[model samples]
Target: MKTMVQIVDYAERGQSLYIQLAVTDGETEKRISGEVRFLGELLYGELVHDKKSPLSEQARMDTIAYLKAHFGR
Candidate 1:
């Protein structure tokens, strides 16, 4: 599976950011939105589907890795 992330909104000058996470595997794709807090080197957040279902562990980890790689400082 391949994952991509897009920033939808930001608050507090980078203290927090809202993002859309998209994952694609072959012909299937899934998307979710979540808020992430960036405090120094710590990054954490919760991702939920449109129907409020919890994301799979792999999806969550992939999203976090993408965010950290692109957005972390």
Candidate 2:
């Protein structure tokens, strides 16, 4: 068995962080996935979790306000 994985790139935008990664097992295969992460809000960033939660109008507005104030960007 082999193992190797590392973050190739990342970008920060307010309350969101976009991440790119390169993963390999030192064999003959590679995998990749992209995702957005919200600070202090795991469910808000997760695909499965977010879908279960409520992304209501109020929730979106609140998130905007939070990101603007916390990240100042």
C-alpha root-mean-square deviation, each candidate: 4.7, 12.1
Clashes of 1: 0
Computed on alpha carbons, the lDDT of every model, listed in order, comes to 0.56, 0.42
The Cα error of candidate 2 at residue 21, in Å, is: 0.4
Q: Tens digit of lDDT per residue, candidate 1, span 1-73?
A: 5555566765645555544444432223556555666666666555633234355655566656776788764
Per-prediction TM-score, please? 0.56, 0.36
Best by TM-score: 1
Report, for all candidates in order, the number of backbone clashes.
0, 0
**Residue pairs in steric clash, candidate 2?**
none
Best-fitting candidate, scored by lDDT: 1
lDDT of 2 by residue, 1-73 (tens): 2333444576777766654534333333434233335554432333114354233334434444444354344
- lDDT (C-alpha) at residue 22 in model 2: 40
